[model samples]
Structure formats: structure tokens, C-alpha cells
Target: MSSEKKNKMPLGGIINKGGTCEDYDTGGWRKFRPILDKEKCIDCLICWAMCPDSAIIVEDGKMVGFNLDHCKGCGICDVECPDKVKAIAMIDEKVAKKG
Candidate 1:
């Protein structure tokens, strides 16, 4: 590709800029969302550490909830949580929103 074309493609050919993830509202792309079982949560913070979208909301060192506007509904949180514990559950977006 030409130099001009290469620059337009983005640095290192990455489709998106690094800092833009926080600026973009990618929640619309989600088909599912994570529902937290507060009672079941052990405060392990696995979900917070593994979340690709950084959607896990922590307040005062506790997992509060998610930022639905920024969460893309990726199930990393659900997957990252211990299998036996299963603190986070992925649910259909429509049902999640209704509840």
C-alpha cells in the first residue's frame, strides 16, 4: 500500500485508536450482558481484571456493577469468574434490560 494509504489505515494497521475505546459507546453491539449475583460474588475481582471493555464498575474496592453504556456485553467476565462460583452470568440483552 502507498504511504498515504498506510497512514490512513491507522498506526500499526490497528483498526481503532487506543484511547478511543473509552470514548466510543460500543454497547449497541452487544447481544448479551452480564448479570451479577451480588450475593454470590466473592469480591475476587476476576471479572474486573479480565473484562476486555473495562465495563466492570468498582467502588471503594468493591465490585458495584457494570457501565452498560460502555459494556459491549462480551462474556469475558462470566468466563473469567471461577467455574464453581459463577458470580457473573451472561443473559440476553433484552431480558437483562427488562430486569
Candidate 2:
């Protein structure tokens, strides 16, 4: 009945701070991770534009890597890449960790 208890139902948490989630590393929640093939990449930056988490890393107007700390493995980047290039591939997280 109290305000403190009102937000404590199921899957609940308090928003102590107001800003982006830069402090929270949500990459551990990913079931799959994207791998980029530089050879096939054309640096079109389509992946960077389509990523929901803004996980795509670019430098000097080129795709360089991924910001895994914030990436939730949504696979949007892979889907957004050019079909002819197919530069991004989604690999299972478990398999990727082994290597």
C-alpha cells in the first residue's frame, strides 16, 4: 500500500539514477553474439544505424568493432547488413566464449 512497496511487485527495481545504462553491463544477457567479417564488410555503416542498443562501433567513418558491454544480442545489426555482403553473422554466445 506504500509507494516504496508499490514498485516491488514482480521483476521490479527502482530507478535511482536518471540517464543512459552506461554503468550497467547488459551484454551477459545475450544468447547470441555477432561476429563481423572484415573482408566482406563494405563499411556502409548500415549496421551502426540499425542497432537498437547502439552496439555497433565505428571509427573514422568505418565499422571497426562492437560495443559488447551494451549490446543485448538483438541481432538487428546482422539483419540490417547488406544481403550481398552478409558481413555480420550471429553466433551462439556459448560457442563464441569457448574460443
**lDDT of candidate 2 over 21-70, digit per residue (tens):** 78889999999999999999999999998888888899999999899898
Model 1 CA deviation exceeding 4 Å by range: 1-18
Q: List the residue pairs that clash in candidate 1.
A: none
Candidate achieving the largest TM-score: 2
lDDT tens digits, residue span 6-68, model 1: 635556767554676677899998999888999988888988998888889999889999988
TM-score per prediction, in order, is 0.76, 0.80
Candidate 2 lDDT for residue 70:
88
Which stretches of model 2 miss by more than 4 angstroms? 1-18
Model 1 — which ten-residue stretch has the worst lDDT?
Answer: 1-10
Identify the leading candidate in terms of lDDT.
2
